[model samples]
Target: GAGVSQSPSNKVTEKGKDVELRCDPISGHTALYWYRQSLGQGLEFLIYFQGNSAPDKSGLPSDRFSAERTGGSVSTLTIQRTQQEDSAVYLCASSLAMVTDTQYFGPGTRLTVL
Candidate 1:
């Protein structure tokens, strides 16, 4: 099947606005993850969903950041009241299962909050 895909590869928004990023994981994949990467920084884990289990959201930077996976396939990451510091590339990855599997990443959505 195809690899993960994300919509709106690039987004530029004013500070205080909100943005929603979408991801489509590979068919049959049961694990999904969202990460953020700022310039010169490593990828920061944001949220994760595995099968029917509760999502692990401890990595979310703030309450304004949230994500959900519907039908165990597609995922959306929403950032509320965006700030300049929120500027970064949002990456999505998925694997067949949660343990010891290679995660394939999407191209990433580059967000620039002005």
Candidate 2:
């Protein structure tokens, strides 16, 4: 199967606007994750989904950030009321399971909030 795919590879928006980033994980992958990376920084975990269990969203920076996965395959990350500090790349990754598996990442969605 194909690797994860994300839509709107690049986005530029004004402060306080909303943006939706979509991701399509590889088939049969039960674990999915969302991460954010700022300039010259490491990947910051945002949210994670595994199988039918409750998603671990502890990494979300604020209440305005949220994500959901459908059928354990496609996922979407939504950022409400974007801010300048939110300018960074949003990455999506997936694996067969949560532990002892390699996560394959997609080409990140570069978001620039002005």
Please give the CA lDDT of all the candidate structures.
0.96, 0.94
Highest-TM-score candidate: 1
- Residue 100's lDDT within candidate 1 is 97
| Cα RMSD, each candidate | 0.7, 0.8
Separately for all candidates shown, the number of backbone clashes (residues 3 or more apart, or on different chains) is 0, 0
Runs in model 2 lying further than 4 Å from the true structure: none
Candidate 1: misplaced stretches above 4 Å? Answer: none
Task: Report model 1's TM-score to 2 decimal places.
Answer: 0.98
lDDT tens readout by residue for model 2, 4-99: 999899999999999999999999999999999999999999999999999999999999999988877899999999999999999999999988
Error of 2 at 60 (Å): 0.3
* Candidate 1 per-residue C-alpha lDDT over 14-77 given as tens digits, one digit per residue, 9 for 90 to 100: 9999999999999999999999999999999999999999999999999999999999999999
